[model samples]
Every structure is written in structure tokens, then in C-alpha cells.
Target chain A: GELARAQPVSTPEVEAFLDTLKWDKNGLVVAIAQNVDTGAILMQGFANRDAISATIASRRATFFSRSRSQLWTKGETSHNFIHVQDISIDCDRDSIVYLGQPDGPTCHTGAETCYYTSVPMDEPKLLASTLYALEELIARRKTEEIAPGAKPSWTRRLQQDPKLLCSKIREEASELCQTVEASEGMERTVSEMADLLYHSMVLLSVQNVKLEEVTTELRKRFGQSGIEEKSKRPPKPTAG
Target chain B: GELARAQPVSTPEVEAFLDTLKWDKNGLVVAIAQNVDTGAILMQGFANRDAISATIASRRATFFSRSRSQLWTKGETSHNFIHVQDISIDCDRDSIVYLGQPDGPTCHTGAETCYYTSVPMDEPKLLASTLYALEELIARRKTEEIAPGAKPSWTRRLQQDPKLLCSKIREEASELCQTVEASEGMERTVSEMADLLYHSMVLLSVQNVKLEEVTTELRKRFGQSGIEEKSKRPPKPTAG
Candidate 1:
């Protein structure tokens, strides 16, 4: 007679799970603090590998305390715990990204991240990048490296004749003036104007004018009444 | 009478499409600034709305100023214009979200947002929402508000037998201990611990223990050395 056999279980049962489990020293583990808002890594600290362990076990956020030199639960004091949704390490595995919903602001000063000032990107990075691209294209054109294609690259065409870039700048400026006259949806106007300005920047770069130079000149004109600045400028003598 | 075949006719094409648009007097419009990372609305201000119009026309982010009152093109000086990817206005059409990549930090103070304080969230707001949800659930349990064909809620059961909540708390704490003993991925431990802490808070709320009272008591223990604090506590006296 064939006897009915019980199906063999694949996953570990709860009792067996307990036997396989090990112990954490304290409810603490090391945690690296990061800015949730700006995507900037702020500071690093430890949670009781056990506290952190507990946090993960509990599905709440916890961290180790370096100041007390012990495992202390987050939100225990401030009632604010960094909820952990997911964590992943980098290629080298030295750091981690603790991604989750932050209970409140992170920085002790209450700012988003620590590094606020960014002088490195003084000019718009896009404008700078575009300008660099134009310059490189111009240099390539001079060396006969400009490729012929169905869709003519603006830069390649401009490289063939520098005057074309200048004319485009003038055209863009005049177009901007016309757009200003019919003022609705400043959004579109601003967008088109940016294109004009970026193209203008390319022309300027071709002529060796840096963004800083323009900014310096604009700064000199700042804080002065527009009328006052205009009055101080040398006149065109009314063009006869 | 038949119309004569007309020669190819061309309507006027402006040099720049934006130049055809017009703006209002004072050349200013409202630019609503918000924290790019955290979706918090910060203070709003006017841009010469025209200078910004010009900046926008130039494909750069610009703002109108009311004080010096000229259009302040963002990144004009700092070279950090909020790069324009897309722009949308609110229902009333007074404010806007300049949804683009901010080249660098937006705040003048070098912090992320203008509001940098994480003061204790006012209690009234807390009570009306989160606290209210907890209270309503507890009250339902107390009333034994079981619906047709519904699994009994832990809260409802706890309300029926108040001592059971305490027992569960003790049980979870012991389970947490076992998880911690196994030094391993502490994440699971934290998740379980959060449940314990949250449940503990519910019990405290049910028992009329104010959170502030607990916080005040904890504050007293803050600067004391862990060793000193732990040593002073008497160990459980053994029963004869």
C-alpha cells in the first residue's frame, strides 16, 4: 500500500530559524548620517550594531551613539528616527546610502546639508558646457575635422563661418526684444531668451569673453538705478 | 470672377519668436522660490520681471527685484541660474515652480532652505491628525466595534483585556533580545524594535502618560556617564 507522505518543507520553520540565528551585542550598529534633501553625505557615526540590528528588525530607524560611546536608539530622545527603507553599499564598500523618509531635517544647524556655497559653478554649467562644445567644434573645423552630415550641426556650421554665429546672436537679441513687447507667459519668453543668451555666450566665447567678465561688468551696473546708469553712459550722439 | 494666382506670400517671421511677446509695466512679475529638494514653499519675491524676462529670454533663470528693483537674473552674479527645463504656474496663476536643475545652492545663507529650525512640531497639529488616528482606533477597540466577518484588531482585543497589551510588550522585548543575541544584519532588529516602541507609545497614550513627561525625565539622564548610571542601579535581588 502506498502511504501518503507529508510534503517536505523548503523554507526554514520559525523554531529552526531561532536556532540558526546569532546574537547582537547591544541594540546598536554604526550608521552614516546623510542629507536626505540635497543628496549630500553629511557625517558618519555608529549605531549599536545591535541597536541598528534592532532597528532593522523592527523596521524603524536606529543608530549608534559615538558621543555616549554606546548604543542609543534614535527617536528615543528627539522622537525623530531616520526610517530605513533600503540601503546599498558602493563598489569599494566603504560607505552606504541610507535611503528613506527623513522624520525631519537632518543637520544639527537645521539646514539641509553643510556645504551651501558653490563658487566652482559660478557661471551656469550648461552655458559653460555648451560654450566649451562650441569652441571645440570651432577648433575641429579649423583642422578640417568637421564632418559633413544630413543634419548640419549648428556648431560645425558656425565653425565654417564665424560671422554666421555673430549674426545669429544679433538676430536672437532682436527677437528677444520683440518677445518682451508681447508679454504673456513669461515662461516661454524666458526659455527662448535663455537659448538666445546661450548662443550669445557661444559667440562671446568665440571672441574670448569669459562669463566672469560679463558678471563683473553686470555687478558694476548693479545697485544703480537703471536710468542713472543709462544717463552716465556715453551717448551715441543721437546718430545725427 | 476668379482670384488671380497669388505669388508666394510670406507673413512676417520675427527674428526671435520670444521677441514678439510682451510684458507688463515695471518689467516685473512674481517668482515663487521653493526648496528644490524638500518641496517647501519659501518666501516669494518679484523680479524686474523684465530683467528676468530678459534672463529667461536668454534661457537663464531670472527674478525681478522690488528693492533695488531691477530684474535679478539668478546666477547672474553667482552664475547659478536655476536652469530652465520646465515651468508651471499655480491655479490662481500668481506663483510658479521653476522645475529645473539648480546649478548650485539656491539659498543666500548657504543653507538649503531659508527656514532652518526643527522646533518641536506644535502639539495641536499633532493631536488633530496622527494622535487622533491612534485615539480613534483605541476607542473602537474599547467599544468592541467588530464588523461582520472581520478579523479582530489587536487594539480591539487589547481594549477588551487591557492586561494583554502589557503582556505583548514584554513578549516583543524578549523576542528582540533573541534577535540581538545573534550578531547579524541589525536591520531586522530595528524593524521589530520600532513596532515595540510604537506599541509602547500607544500603551502610554492609552494610559494617559504624556509624551512630554517622558521626554522631561529622559532629559535629566542626558549628560550622566553610562557606567555611573548603570552601576547605581541595583541588580535584581535574588529570592531566598
Candidate 2:
């Protein structure tokens, strides 16, 4: 008990907690940090004994950087630190999860998390974040070097030429309008929407913006009067 | 249409469009800018005839600033501009919604939109963003001027003391663990959760981070295998 008082967790508390996790052969446990309140899984990393010790000792989420081959404390560079809240192991005990409270975006590219991108993202619930996924991919493409014999991606090519990107957005938007004005139950609208969505993702990617923020805007207005919401806004600073 | 060009819309078309709006006494209409592809509303502003004209002329979102008493283009100073896609008047004609393609976050606080804050937010969808709202509120409290004869808010005081903030978070987190282990569907669990969530938000806000990003991490993992997802991660740079 002496080890548990007056700090986030004492050295013994850290040791006791680490003792519970069933580490892999490499003396590392897969650490998946989750949001404690919402029960939302946040991000995942690897933690060796030292890393786990560092995490509980400091009460910040620390992990073994596989690439660096040493203990790594998240947000060491970006200051987007993850605060360890509660640690739990899976039923099988082969993996561990640290309910981490993150201070800012966790992903390296400044999006929300490291797991934003998913392949074949084809589920109904997953649809909501699809645009965001595309936005992240386009962002990755911006700095990612192409593999030999791989066709150059349009997002990168457009990033090189801003004019084409802007024009493409406008063009796709016009097509969406036409699709909207089409006959009742027009099937073409979905395809047109996909076009617009792709182009808009490209546009947002170029600007280095993520799509989740937009959904947050929508969620804020869920029940409130639009006029009232508008009124509450801090006035935009006027021009000179 | 003098503004007509090889684009999604033309100049005369723009003027004809604005003609449908029933502007208020000051010839202004409330403009709600939305994400064209996602349909998530982005931001809101007031638009006079001149502002609308400028928006069309420049294809940028220009608003009549109430404070400056002049036309202001979004991102004029911050370079976080909103690119106008399509403008449509609401059924009432007193308001308009602009399908905007934002180049960056539209809010002055570097948030995605101006309408992020909500109160007593209780709903299915609102639940996800509620943590974010709390985060934003705590952040605002950090910068808000003290009112005359008002009790100092805990969040405010906690912001002033980093050590106290860290301790408070740890305390609440421990309580949450106890509650979780209680009887099935224990009522105190929710309250403990609220406490932990609040403390976490304060901790994040002090670190200049918001909670929406955390939820995005959850939303992205909606329909995937955590194991497979974990494996796909680009190997963290090793051998530094």
C-alpha cells in the first residue's frame, strides 16, 4: 500500500501490474491502449518489461519501439502524450491493454490515431469513417515514395499540380449536382457521390485536414436549433 | 452568365442563385457551411449580398463579419480557408447552406468548426462526441477570463496546477476500477465513469489535446480484427 499512495502509481504497483500480463517470447506484450470512458480502443504498441515498468512508473503510456529497439514514450516529440488510466489483460492473457487517455492526435501524420487506415473497409458502420480513411491514405501518399513498377497514384500527381486538383473537385461537384437533380430514386447518385467523396477527400488531404472533425460538427448540431448554434459562435474577426 | 466558365458553376448562375434567398433586414442570410461529400455541416457565418458576391467571384467563403463590419474571407489570415462548392437556400429562404470544401480547420481555435460546443449533450450519436465537447469546454475554461465574484471552477484551478491535475486523474481512475468490479450493471459505475472521463478531459485539455480524436480511434476500429489491424501497422522505425 505504501507504493500506491501520493502518486499515479508507486513502483510496486507498477511491478504488480506488469506481473499480470503474459508477455510474448520476446519479453514484450502487445499493448492496446483504449479510451477508458468510452471503451473505445485507441492505439496499439509493443511493451517490453522495461517499457511496462516505465509506463507504470511514470503513469504515461510507454512502449518498445520495434524499429528503434528501445523503450519509447509516446508524445515524446509531438507532446500528444497518452496518460495510462487502467491496464487490463485479454481473457487469454497473451496480450495487454492500457486504457490510455491521450492528450492529442496519436497518429504520426497528425490525424487522430495510428489505425485510421483499413483495407477493404466495407461495413455499414465502417462507412461513416470511410472518407476519413481515404483522406488519411491520400495524406500518406503525399510523402510516401512509390514502389518500382507501381502506377503513380492520382492523389500524389494532383498534389504536385494544385490546379488540376481544384478543377477536379469542382468537376466532381458539378457531377454530384447533376446526380442530385436526376429523376426520383436515381441510382447514379451513389456513384456520383463516390466521385465527389473521393475528390473531396483528395482536396481535404491536400489541405492536410481530416474528415472526422466534420462529423463532430454534425454531431454538435444533432438536437440544437441551427440558428441558436450559429448565434453561439464567437464572432469571426473582421477585416481591416 | 458572365461568371459561366468550364467549371461546376458560372457567374450569372451564382447571381441567379443568390436571388432566391430572402435576406434579413440587413440583407444578410445565415450561412451554414457543410461538407459536400460527408454532409457534415462545417461552420456558419452571415453573408450579405456583397459577401455572397465575393464568395462567388473568388470561389472562397466570404462572410460579413459583425465585429469588423466588413467582408472577410475565411482563412484570410490563418490560411485555413474554406472553398465554396455549392450554395443552396433553406426552405425558409432566411438561411442558406454552403456546401464547402474546407482547405483546413474552419474554426478559429484550430477546431474543424465553430459549432463544436454543446450542452447537456445526451443522445446515441452525441455520446461519442460528448467527451470531445467536455474537452473543448475545459480548454475554453483554461483561457476564459475570470468573472466577477464567481466561484473558481475546478477545471480552471486544475489547469493552473499540473501536479494536482495528474493526481486527480489517478484518483478518479482508481475509483473507476473499483466501480467496474462491482455488481453487474452497478449504478455507481456511470458516476465513476463520469468522474474519470472529466478528469481525463481536463488532463488532455491541459496538454492542449481534445477528445474527439480519441473517439475517432474507436470509430475506425468498428468492424475489424484488432490482431490483423495491429499487424498491418507500418513497422515503427527500428534501429535508430
Candidate 3:
């Protein structure tokens, strides 16, 4: 039954699109799947022509498992499929992006995305992905049961006390403002801003809000600005 | 002069690290370069053993250019070299990360990163990377000269009027609080929070504060939490 579903589609449009791809010698191209809603890059893999065809036809992100040397539909067993809405090829034509919505955590480790681990540094540091990571960690702490006699985590305390969470947000916001008014250097401004972001994220988690929702809202505003700017530009020259 | 500097280091430590890598059939592995300070992933490319060696030895991000069939130092021509501070391999050992500081924008198109293009959507949308993108856009608008007779953009107005900027931040922050106090649904909460985040970023930009600094501060806090948690864990079992 699965094999039948995985069969490649050979429509004229599909064929035309596939023809433009610059597959490597191994007849594979790099394919990256991104969460359309959250904008999190879920995972990356290589896909052969069949995999691409299957992905488009099934609307499920499928990739060539280099180790297994066969096509693998992500979440086939886990049932956390990345249901692709649209696929776009990069300017290079050698890479493809499957903009999709994931049903559950995309990483096998149960993390939302695969790109969680940051490179080690001389001093402890976080990656840009830390925003998403913090969201996940805060969520985990919410449901996690404290060991018997173990102190409740700060996150737990904040989650339990709504007033505390809100107060922290306001307090952090004020500190952020102080940094600006005091003409604090970059370091202090960043520090205060970080505190505010962390506290805001805690409130979001307590309220059962996903960070993706916030990002999606931001994207909407950015797109509106882009549209406004585009309308002011002169019309493009049509192809001869 | 550059050639001498690109020589691969062949120390035992380097050799040991290289041996752990599971290179592809083409003797290459995916190498991602991230800005250590800002936590921005600057670019992704492939690297061989020699490329990795050269990167470690030179402390500059290096990659194997498949098209050119030779080692190439990023920013050799652009002078936007990513000065690597440390390198880390993923758990799979099939990929690597070079965490470094960028001298300037990393993309050839002058974008902060190459991952700016989002997949085409039925409705216009912004990617999660929009936060950094917005910062760049705001910064550009601050210095951009308005064309004669052209209207000043909203960003331009915000930049020119500090009072307006500060007021907006305060207003958005209050709205965000109202969402919580009034029991606003997820949609409204996310919308207000996004507005607050956007305004906060604008203020940070006006203050010449980089988003990376904020992320670094958050990372330091996360690390402190990690350290506290680790101290409580039972010691690992020793090898026989």
C-alpha cells in the first residue's frame, strides 16, 4: 500500500520542473524542509528525482536516505509528516525547499527542529536558534514533574505564578528602556533586551502560546511593508 | 601570501578530529558557518579534511569549492572573512559547524545571510529570520537618503524622531500587557507581542545595539542554568 502511494508522478508540469534541476552526478539534489508556519528549518537531506516526484505528488516531504540508499518519507513510521504546501528551488537550482507544516516535532530527538545543537565556544554561548530552543525548554519545564523534595525550577515558579510572570515582563521591559535612556553601551542594552525576551518567552509558554505565532505575526507586518514599498517602484521591463 | 596562509595543519589533534568525521562518497561533509557573536548562521558549504584543517590552522572559515575544485577562503575577495573561534561536529559526525565572527555581511547580495529567500506562499509571509532581516532593513533606512519629493517611510520617521520611537515601544509594551490582563486569545496576544518585539528591535537599532549581543546574554543565562543542573547530576560511570 505504501509503495503504491510512493510512486512518482509524471505530469507534464512536474516533468518540466524536474528538467530544470541541476542534480549532482549521483542524481541527487539537496532538499531542505522548512516549517511554513513557524519558519523553522525542520531538516535537510538529499533527494533523487523519484523522491522529488513523490514529495510533490504526496505533498509529504520525502528524501533519499543516503545511508539506506532508498527513498524515505519523513515521519512515515513516526506519523509526524511534514505536509508540504509548496516547493521552491533556490537561485542555484541545485537546492530545493519544501515549505511545509509539521504535525509534530521534526527532529528524531523530539526537538522541534534538527538544528538545535550550537557549536562549542571558549565561553558558553547560544546560537541564533536559541530563541526556538528556549521556547522548547520552557515548555518542557511546564509539564515536567519535579523530583520528590527537589526545589521547583524558576520556570516552574513563574509558570505557577501568573502575576510573577507578568511582573517580570514589565520589569524587564523597564530595564530595557533604562538601557536606552541611560545611553548604555551595546553590551548592557543587549543584556537588558535578552532579559526581556527571556521573560516574555516565559509568559508565552505559561499562556500556552507558541513562539511561531509571534514570528508569523511579525512576518505579516514585514510583508505589508514590502508590498507598500514595491508599489512605489517603477514597473519592471517586460521580456521582449 | 594567501596561499602560504592557507596551508593545512597536520597535527595529531587535527588528525584525530578529522578521523571522527564520516565524509560522503565525494570525501566531503556539510560545513555550516555561524556568527559566534550574533549567533547568525552566515552560510553553508562543503568541506573536506584539508579544508577543515586549513580552517582550524588559519582561524578563518574555509570550504572546498566544488565548482573550482580547490580550497577557497570565504571573503578572500570580499574581505568579509569569518574569523572562526571554535569548531564543533554534530552528533551524527556527518556535518560540522565553524562558529566565528564576521567582518561584515556574509552574502554576495549584501544580505546578512544567504537564507533570506523564503518559499513562495499563497499569501505573503515572513520567515522566522525576519527579526534579523527587520533590523537590517531599519538600519538601512536610517542612513538611506530620501529621494527628492519622496515621502519619508515609517522607519525613516521613527529613526528621525526619538520621542516617537520611545513612545511606540512603551505603547506596544502596554498593549502586550493588556493582552494578558484582558485574557486575549492566542492570536491577539501573538500580534501584540510581535508589535512589542518589532518596536523593541527598532529601539535597539537606534541605540546601535546588535541582536547578537542580546542572544549572547540569553545564552550566558542558559549556560548558567545548565551548570547548575549539571552540578546536581550523578557522576558518570567510569570506564573499566
Candidate 4:
């Protein structure tokens, strides 16, 4: 929990006006972009009056192009459009966050998100995007009709036949289990689990099944009883 | 436009980890919820293992309920949930920004956002929501075939007949022009113009037309040659 201990800046009327006032000359504010569906930090930029106005007016994120001294709407050239659901300023009024949906990979590079540098913790956008992509891939699999041992789009293949995909999901899950059983810390355990879950999502997507469906069914069978839900799923087949 | 003069904290990998080591008492991080849609400071809360994991797993914003000391997923109860898209961390490595789509009002009080009070600026989400609601009402008029004069709802009546809505828009524009013609300073003129524009948006939304559509059309018709775009719009229908 956070406490906004800092007193509200005095001079309420002026502060209010300042809050509403658009940037003059060089005034700017930090703007961070995050995925609304997956909970990932995509990128960060700066906003001036022109950029902020454009962003709000378009319901898409925009930023002042410091390099060109002009407005730069993200994905303007790439078409990796981000649709803004909302925007908020921080307590100090120095920064903002744009929460919205992403149309494609946020980073110019092929990565799912912008921040690639390992900053100890994965930047939120990357994680969200990766998960979102996996979800998309999984959903796609459900609609795809393919044959066993046939090379379709990886996702299509996963969906055309469940056996192989299940095998992978089980393999990844076992790996995840190994990490936890070995007493690996949160970082390793989380990383392994993420891989397992992602594969599982991919498997589900290929089948055209929704995670929500599984959740609803689970809830129905268990009725808020996690222990009971776990007890009901068929046991995993032994390693081949 | 924003420049954070705060120097990037650089440290040896080991040193950085050691220096910023938060004891794993609960094994969680602090999450701050700001209204990305409205620029409001909603609330502050924490994420424990279950909270963070559930948020990531579900792709919905979840925070640890400090009072209950358990994982609390926002929107779980209200259905006005924040579907997380991206996340980020401050340089200090202590706090995070969760960006996502808010299902409805973020605050419990039915405000457009969580950080409603004390925020002075005209938040985008508030304006957007108002505009969105107005647009829906307008669309309903066209779709449901309501009668303008006989309709009970003011917005519905205006939308049922385009001519009436157009007349209101013209009246507001005329009033705005009169104010501008009489006003002296920049601030007063700008203020009057904003009101005019806002009313104009309401009128436009009522027609099942978005301001973006007009702007986009203007850009398309007059984007390459600005002069031509201006020449085509019928000179504001000659205020009469």
C-alpha cells in the first residue's frame, strides 16, 4: 500500500489552473505506455501540448518527438497502434500513464514489447504482451483444423491435434514442477511456470477454447474450492 | 517534452541487488493505481504472491487487500474491472504503474475514475465517457427510430432528427463566434472556444458521428492541401 504523504501543493486555484494548462515553450511530462490486457510496460516517452492534444483527440498515444521537435504518434509508421482506454497523471503532476489496447508488437524490433534490457524485473509491458500473444495464439488454435504430424502454423498444428500440444504442455509443466521441487526461488520458478502456462494457453487457443471457459467450468466443479478442483482433473499420463 | 533530471541509478549487478534488497517478508511489490484514463490518483495498494501471480495469470489488475491481508482482484466484485495491459517500475525499483482498460468507473463512488477528487484537469476519460454515452444515445435514436418532437429523452429527440441536432450545433457555434467577436484576451477567448467545441462534440455525438470522423475527413480532404479542405466545408453554413 502507498501513502500520499506529500501535502497537496498549496495555492489550490493556481495549482488547479496549472493542472489544466497545456505546456508552453518547453514544458513537458513523462508518459509511459502499458498494455491494458496483459499488464506490461511497452515504452516510455514525453508529452507536450501538441502531443497530448493529439493523443487525447485520437484516443491513441502520442508524444513530442524530441528528435524532430514535432509530434510522434506511436506506431504511426509501424502501425502497431495503441488504442487509449484512459490516461492518468501521477501525484506530482510530472508523469502520466497511458492504459490501452495494443494492436501488435509494441517494440519496433520483433520483441513483444519495447523494454528488452534485463532490469532484474521484466518490464510490465513485455510480460503482458508475451502473455497476450500466447493467448492469441492459443485462441487461434481452437479454430484451426489440421492433421496430426502435419506441419501447420505452429499454433495451427497445436490445435489440429491435441495430443502433441498436450505433451508439450505436460513437459513444460513438469519442468515447472521440477523448478519448484528443487526449491528454486521465485524468479526461476516464475520463469518456468510462465513458460508452462503460455504453452497451455497456446494449446487452449488452438482448440478455440477460452481460458474463461475453463475458469467457469473449474468454478462450477469446485465452487470456490481449489482443493476440490485439483482433485477432479484427470491425472497426467506417465512420461513416454 | 519531459526530461527527468534524476540520474539513472547505476550499480554493479550484485551491488544493486544488495542495495535495494527488500526483505521477502511477504514476497510482493507495491502497486499504485492511478487513473490512466483520467489522470487521477485512485489509490495505493500492495501485491503479494497471490495478488501479483493472479494479476499476471488472469490479465486483470489485482492488488493485495491490506485490511483483509489477502489477494483482492479489483473489478472481481464490481465487474468494472481494470484489465491490465502493461506495467512499469520507477527507477527506485520500489513502485509500479499498472496500465490497462478499466471496465467502468475505477472508483467505488461511480466517478469516471478512481482519482476523481483533488484532480483539477479535465480528465480525458471523463470527457471520453460523456462523449461515448452521448454517442450511444444518438445511435439509439437512429436505430430505434424515435420521433424527435415526441421523444421523452432530450438527447434521443435531438438524435432522432438530424436537422434539430444540426440546428443546436449551429446555435452553439454562433454563440461561440459571438463570444469570440466580443472577447479581448486569449484566456477568455480560449475558454469560450472550449465550451463551444465541447457542445459541438455533444451535437456531433448525437448524430452517431465522432469528432474523430470529422477531423479525419478534414485531414483526408484537406490533409495534403490544407487550403482545399477549408474551401470544401461550405463555409460553416453562413451563421445567418
Q: CA lDDT, every prediction?
A: 0.38, 0.52, 0.71, 0.48
How accurately is candidate 1 docked according to DockQ?
0.01
Report chain A TM-scores, every model.
Answer: 0.36, 0.46, 0.62, 0.48
Q: Of the true contacts between chains A and B, what fraction does model 3 have?
A: 0.24
* Per-prediction TM-score to the true structure, in the order listed: 0.25, 0.29, 0.65, 0.33
Worst ten in a row by lDDT for model 1 chain A: A1-10
Pick the winner on DockQ between candidates 1 and 4.
4
Clashing pairs in 3: none
Instruction: Choose the strongest candidate by TM-score.
Output: 3
- Write down the worst ten-residue block by lDDT for model 4 chain A: A1-10
Give fnat of each prediction, in order. 0.00, 0.00, 0.24, 0.03
Better of 2 and 3 by TM-score: 3
TM-score of 4: 0.33
The per-residue C-alpha lDDT of model 3 at residue A13 equals 71
After TM-score superposition, the amount by which residue A26's alpha carbon in candidate 1 deviates from its true location, in angstroms, is 54
Candidate 2 residue-wise lDDT at A174:
44
In terms of lDDT, the poorest run of 10 residues in model 3 chain A is: A231-240
For residues A1-240, write the lDDT of model 1, one tens digit per residue.
011111122233323422333322443222444322222333334443344344444434445554565445444554455554444322222223343344664445554322222211123321111222233333443345434554334544543444455445444433433333343344434443443434444443344443323322322222122312332343222110
